[model samples]
Target: MRHTDLFYLLALQKVEGVGEINAKKLLSHFGTAEAIFAEKSHKLKKIDRIGSLTVERLKDKSVFEKAEAELRFIEKAHIRAIAFTDKDYPEKLRHCPDSPIVLFSNGNIDLTNRRIISIVGTREITAYGRDFCKDLIATLAPLDPVIVSGFAYGVDITAHLAAIENNLQTVAILAHGLNQIYPKMHKKYMSQVMENGGFMTEFWSSSNPIREQFLQRNRIVAGISEATIVIESAEKGGSLVTASMANDYNRDVFAVPGRISDKYSQGCNNLIKTQKANMLTSAADLVYMLNWDLQQPIKPVQKQLFITLEPDEQKVYDFLNSHGKELLDIIALECSVPVFRLSGILLNMELKGVIRPLPGKLFEVI
Candidate 1:
């Protein structure tokens, strides 16, 4: 965006009582941020939702000073400001009614024709969640989806690392400004993340990573992706908030189930039980649900006429054969195999061409 245009947009944001929705409305009527400022007070008041008080606030000239300072910071820091009208702005997020008018981004970030998904969960990630997240990203590597998450500890950082390891573009939505990194400990990963994908935020340089900022940042994380997956969370956490937001935006939501006794699993289990999210056990579930086609055509697997199956693989195959199509959890339960172990057994069966993986983590006999 042009520097002068960005300057006006920033000033528009500083207008008290003017938010994303109202700002967008004014912009629509006037066609540009400059025009909105140039319009007469009576003309602005004629628009719906633009009350007299808001018109008065729009006359505040101090906002221009703040916008100019922010513009200088953006220029010095080499940050790219993505306006709502920019083709480079995230398409999914752009469609959101409450999306920020401008997004500040840095690094080699690219979202062109990319499949984006957000993975969020508890900060106190457990071994099970970590392994699941790693394996999930690894499996999805073939599809090459862009991973989005908060640049925080635990699940968010784990997801980002997994994406980096797989050579996938990973974007970290910051709760604060680009001028500083939060947690301080994550400063080491910043370089690598910037090289691989980059950092994005709607906050200005003056903003800090406070509690409310994180909550507000969650909307971008949820809205920017086609789907949001909860790896693990307690009965209450920020991941659930993202899931709720994704659902509200009419995007698909998935949750990894865990043992009932595990505190971190309670939230995911509740989401599934309450029909708020689909049960996610494998990358196949997400790919299928999102209707994401593989970039390269998958080679057809030919079944060996007399392939041998190990005892565990035979059990899984037999269960799938009888059930027609069964979820991973159900096959594990009926066949008495641990989920983690069953994953390997199922993969082997799939390689043998005796069973085929279906959407939503279901498997069927070939």
Candidate 2:
């Protein structure tokens, strides 16, 4: 979109006393943020549910000032903004009732992946949660699906990092600005994710990360994905909240069963007992349950595909998988190919599902 167009949409989103739903309503009513801004309080007051008092209060100069600062911040961060109506915005989100009018993203992943699975669980995760997430992620890495998570500690970060390890794209739904990384321990990993996949959020730069926003962000994570996976959570964990949102959105919800004695397992057990979540033992189970597309075997494994690789890519693939996961730098050195040209080779391998990507610039043979 044009710079002015993005600015206008952000302005409407920044309007005080105006939430996403109402911002969308205003946009639908006026056709554009510019048009909405031109309308007088009296004119807006005539509209049902938009009282004169609300309109007058919305005219505060601070709102525009905040928006202006936000726009500047966007420019500084090189952040991209998307409106619900924009073609790039996720179609699943646009269909939802409480979709945000404007979203802030600082990454490269397409939000509209063919398959998106959101894995959520408790912060005080368990041994089962860790192992289940790693094993399932290893399975999912070969599927070429995008993974969605809140970038929170425990299950969320595990899923994101696992996606990296698998060469799959991941999106971190943030509750705060792109300027700062939360849970500072994940800072380095988040940077890698930003380059490989992306970060997405509805909050503007400088917005405080609050509990309510985190809770609200859960709905988007659930609504945008095709399925939700709860690895481990207490009975009242946020994972349940995400599952509820996914259920309301008619998306599939799956839970990894845990030992009955563990508190973390209670949520998944209860969800299964209540039929709230489909029992998922592995990525294969999820693939079977969702009827996902597995790679159709090449009717004829043409020797031609590997023949033209100039021998270097083959060596890289052979060596990487030979020892399992490897860093790109190591592969480049092993393959004796310039780092610059390694990109095209990696893309080729990724397209064929021959290798998986991992967090922190690591690569593994599939």
Q: Top lDDT: which candidate number?
A: 1
lDDT of 2 at 217: 90
lDDT of 2 by residue, 225-248 (tens): 889999998979788999999999
Clashes of each: 0, 6
Indicate the worst ten consecutive residues by lDDT in candidate 2: 293-302
How many pairs in model 1 have backbone atoms within 3 A of each other, for residues 3 or more apart or on separate chains, i.e. clashes? 0
Per-residue alpha-carbon lDDT of candidate 1 for residues 290-359, written as tens digits (9 for 90 to 100): 7663333445556567988898887777777777899888888999997766775776566566777775
Candidate 1 Cα RMSD after full superposition onto the native fold (Å): 3.6
Candidate 2 collision pairs? 164-357, 164-358, 165-357, 165-358, 166-357, 167-357
TM-score of 1: 0.88
Q: How far is candidate 2 from the true structure (C-alpha RMSD, Å)?
A: 10.3
- Report how far residue 167 has shifted in candidate 2, in Å: 0.6
CA deviation > 4 Å runs, candidate 2:
294-366
